[model samples]
Target: MRKLFVLLISIVVLSACAPVHRFTQLRKLPREYSENYSIEGIKAPRSAAHRKPWIVYSDRVENAAYVNPGGRVKSAEVGLLDTFLVIKTKGDYLRLIKYNPTNIKHNRLTQRKKAEYVGWMHRSRLILSPSSITDVQSGLHDKLLTAITDTTAIMQSATYFTTADSLKVFGDPELQNQTGVVGIHAIIYALKHSVDKRSVLVSKTPSLSADKIGEQVIGWVPAVMLQEIGHQVFTGTAFSRVPTLQKTLKYAPMIYPYHTDSTCSFVSGTLEPVIDKKDNHVFNINGKRISYTRGNQIKQELKRINILFAMEQSSRLPEQYPMLLNAIQNLGPFFAGSGESFSYQFGAAVATPRGMETIPLTADYEILIDRLVKMASYVADTENTPLPAWKAMRSALELIGNTPEAVNLIISVGETGEQQENAPSSIVKTLNEKNCRLLGWQLYASNDDKYNNYVLQLSNMIEHYAEYRTKNKRNMILYADQFCRSNLLREAGPNFLMLDYPYASMTQGGFLFPEKGETLPMELFAGAVDSIVTQIKADHQLLSESIDRAFATVGNGKDRLDSLLIATYHLPQGVKPNK
Candidate 1:
């Protein structure tokens, strides 16, 4: 009876000891491997409500070497988090070993070769494609995802714990000598095993090999579990019983499993499929036992859950749908703003028999302007509205306006003589009457069939204004930019022209003399007139010289004149020539 009792006792003791032996012998993963492996947790520096505990681990020291290759060497002590495994080495600098659970398995380059190739090809296509703009947009999206994932991985592994606390937990004499993970590792191991009662699981089943079990855990388990374990290890007060923490009187691991289910619902539920009337028989069994159908469902669900969890943790997948939806929502007003700016800068016109015609205040131009005015009126309403497209268009327009060549192109288009007859008579009459305020008149003559005749008419109007309309001939001289000198000479005869030489007088006389009884301030009036004359001279010279230069460079002909006419008519700031 005694022998039998002893035998039973022996069996129980052996059974109790089996798990540790199995764990230690199972593959004997290097400490470095286990230490280096990690998973990203909640973002740091977050609000208390947003903060989450970080969790990381590795199967062997060598596995950890991939993150910090110098075989568990000590790195510089960081002020933020004390002792940590050195995972990266550069020059004399070392960084803590970090791991991203999502990319852990993806570390194999061969497996990702196809994806890498495709990505490279896609980028190349973007650069080489005809529609490079669209390609750039897509590439930006992809790049954003990649950057977010990479950044999240780095952030997750960084320790938030202090060095002093770590040293107290590790109790390594060398730590006092050098800032390193040697002490930190000892503490982590002690906390994990002794305090948390969370021994690394080892396979005892003969059929279930250690590698197979590790694979199962790594592949099938959700990353959130690691986080949970980490949380328990870091915050639990159970480790104070250990010799290292007992002396220091520091808090130990606070192993609470509450709210852990929130991280991974599928795992918490044990991968059980939702029960429905149609699938009820999946659980059916002979009256004695449940069958394997439900088990299969559970297994399948578990597999799916594992994959999704891994993907979520590893890739840092963006809330793409939400971001894109928000971006779209923000683009509406931008487009509206762009439309307004476009109409304002480039006067819209209606198609007419002669050609496309600018609408005077009463026509389609007026309607378009009204729409723009309305949009501008509501600028306060949509002041801060996000509209990337509108912003982009506005930027483009601004760029175009800044370039002299681009400005010239637009002016040429506006001045093209083919569209003159389409303008409102009020506008033409105002110009024909030589009114300085109605400066848009020059743009009308740009498209006329008899451009020279129009020019002659303009000169005649200016001459008439000089001779009869104003006593000092001030208005004609002030608005000299409105008349085409070459055209005037060709039609009205050079002898009939009285050029107001403002600069000649200024240079010849010590000061400009006021005419008798002038009380409106002759100096100010003369100064203004001189300025206008200077601008008119420069503009007329530019127009004639540009025409002459074009003829000299390209050969004198009607084509050169035509080109010059087009060029002059398209001046920026409208055809007023003030600019």
Candidate 2:
């Protein structure tokens, strides 16, 4: 009797310690669902709100599931308050992962073993809903980042962070360092901006791996290292009216080379994408999730151009020299005030009593006038000297460097000094090489068809403003002169601009000064200068608008870009500058 009793006790102990029998197939859940099934009496939770992939808790006292759909029960029973990950649905049945209620509070998943069970059950037998289940909320708000700094740490948990070696959620995918992530130029929609003391919560969009579990909790990025986007100084001007760089990016591959079509390009190279690294991965921000990828920074471009004045000072027009100098001097304030981004440099083609030569550019308008004034006291006949004018144009191009990307502008003032060298082709080639534009502002001069034709031959683009003309002379014709109007008219592109068009009896528009005498009043010169300055401002504004349009159509196509450039620089037939 004692032996039998001892044997029973040993069997009971052995049975208690034995591993619970579990279906091997039930332990592993499918990542995706098959066909769904619905039946009467198998209803979703009454309080459930969100749609699809609904997670719910067992409301009943007894919840038993089978290894196969509607098959014999093969798992232990669960009770009220237990959690289940709804895997799939069949006729009157549901496949689920029965997990511990405590485990549901964390982003961590309960691996299918011990506390977690996976099986199929009659939908009517168990009840759950989305609203009935609550998830862990980190209680962090989004932050506006100015920049992402080096040493910024990526965290795996919102609660706490471990050593850098283990918490490698992202960074240097090459695994260059302990962190599994690397930083690059990136734009991101942040999920959460910052945590209490340590890191900012960023998105895992930059992840190459589709880590559904690891991707959700992007971990924490060091808060101190993340910079916020700053405000603009001038918000109303055309230069400043653009979307903030952060507002324009979508939640996708965070790291990408700078795109010319990017709205940020509209604002020039002032702002760039921010990349934050925690552990070893690049993260993004702006109240959304950020993804990382390999990309290069946007190239910086030339925003402003250098404006060089190539004014002619002839010995015959003594009184006109000072007037021209005064006019050029006054333009300094107008150019500066026009809000056009440019630097002004002055040079003069002086035909003094001694000889004719081009004066070098000066920083100060007064200094340039002083030097020219001191060069020659005597003024003689307006010699047909185009050498000095040519020299002035060459000097301007040299100052800015004759690169294909050059954007420097040349403004030639005074008499229509036609180049006697007759090398219009060479001039055109040089101008094309530098991508420069020349504005010919002829004041108090006889209408020279030769000079007009010569100016038209220059490459790239040209703007001629013929000021103060006689009754018979053509006052503001674009590239076409009186004699060669038919031939040269065919040569002009859409970019060619002329004021006062088609020889109106008297040149109309604002202050009018006819070529009555050799010398004109300073007041008339000032008006002409004002008219020219206004035109310059209008052109500058048009260029700004073109740039905005070009970027607006970025990613659209190359044809759109070409069209935009053409439309902005060149006007169609019958179209005139806005008066």
Candidate 3:
């Protein structure tokens, strides 16, 4: 009985260890052999192919290839013991496949530590799975770093890449072509220096369309050229050393357009001359004027004709020869009816031609030039002298002879107290007969006694002559200088009187006053004048009230006083009482 129990225990243990598919074939066996039948007609077990173990590093498994036998094996049915044994035999190969190029910790550890680990793997004692490794090489890393650095450099140097919605590239064809070449060269150079060769080829080639290429080229070329030129102009040299050359070179970039259009050209040649009828001189350059009274009709005509002739001649010359042209025509009518020699000289200079052309010898032109030259020379020579009365008279005659239409002669009179006492009465008489407008005789004022007496004598002689002309049906004007209150409204019962004041005040009084020292502030002087005007108006009102009161108190008797006040006030119409 004990032997039977031992055999049964043995059978039960073996059955438990049998393959699971053995039961599916039991029904086909004979009844006597069913419990102990040999599994026949089964296919011979295939010999296993040599398995090369691979270590694949993946997120789901850690150290699985080393610790687990069939973790990543191609066939899990292979004995787990056999898989673990195979992993051990090929550990070096597994390690090599699983090496991580970017393992910072492994790389940073001591060389001794790395060697110890490698040595264990070689001896098949240590295994590293493929999942722990990454296929990163030193050469590729260096290439990436270089590409990044190059891109940074390009971005830093690119200055002309603007984001404006609309850009104005100067539309000239020639300029655009030159700019294209420069821009393309610059961009290529920048790309060469800033990007990896491979990246530049890959990124910039096929993607850049023809339109984009042209726009970029055009935008950068002129910009770079202008920037370089600006630096040269500021720091490389002085302007005058090669001014025109420098200008020409700078405008080389602009020449394509400038040459084709008149408005675009940047050249100015010469200015035209202006003729001053009152001064009888042509203004060749600038700064010329003339003043004449109504009587100088002949001189005015001559002056106008001279200016027109000069302009006509100027038009015939090259346009570039004259940079500017300014003519003051018909200035003689402004002065009270008299033409002064100095005035005519000034007019002639204002109208003088600027070019080197042979001035046409028309009789009018010759006469105008002769008169102008004579007047200019005389004024230049006699500028400092006190013009004698007879000499002044002769100068007037010369002016009238040169300009036949000259009907009036204006002269400057001495100040109220300083008339030319020795002025010949006959000179004034002759001027009155000729209907001359004498001016500036009243302008002379000085602290000097002799000058004052001379001015007084001159004024008296002028009055005598004016009275004679009035009786003879001829017109005459005695313009007195209002240098002081005494000269303001002289009772010189002449047909015409004009008050002349100095345009500018001088420490030592004269027409062209010199600045001797600091002068009063204009604001203060203006304020003072305003105050004076207010006082004057108040005083005039008081005077009018007094005249009205007197008229009411003595109706008929006040007539004489009213007449006296009217005369004193110089009122054109008689004063009336208030309603």
Best model per TM-score: 2
Model 3 C-alpha lDDT per residue in residues 1-579, reported as the tens digit of each score? 999999998987776553221121111112221111123222222222112222211111111232223234422221101111111233233322222223223223122122212111221212112111111221110110011111122223333222111112222212221111222112121111101212111111212222233222222122222211110112322111335644665536333333554333332221111111222221111222212223244223323211111111111112211221111112223221222211222222111133111222222323444544443333323223232333433344334434343224333222222234555656656555544433332222345555445444545545554445334321111112311222222221232223222121100010111122222122222232222223323322333333333222322221221343344345444333221
TM-score of 3: 0.20
State the lDDT of candidate 2 residue by residue for 412-503, as single tens digits: 55444454524344555555555454555444534555344334333123321122122112211111222122211211222223343233
The TM-score values for the models, in the order shown, are 0.15, 0.34, 0.20
The local distance difference test score of each candidate is 0.23, 0.39, 0.26
Worst 10 residues of 1 by lDDT: 305-314
Candidate 2 lDDT score at position 240: 31
For model 1, residues 172-223, the per-residue Cα lDDT tens digits are: 2111222222121221111111113322211112122222333222111111
Candidate 2 has its poorest 10 consecutive residues by lDDT at: 291-300
Query: How far off is residue 309 in model 2, in Å?
Result: 2.6
By TM-score: ranked, best first: 2, 3, 1
| Model 1 CA RMSD to the hidden true structure, in angstroms | 35.2
Tell me, what's the RMSD of every candidate?
Answer: 35.2, 25.2, 39.5
Task: Supply the global lDDT for candidate 1.
Answer: 0.23
Angstrom error at residue 19, model 1: 28
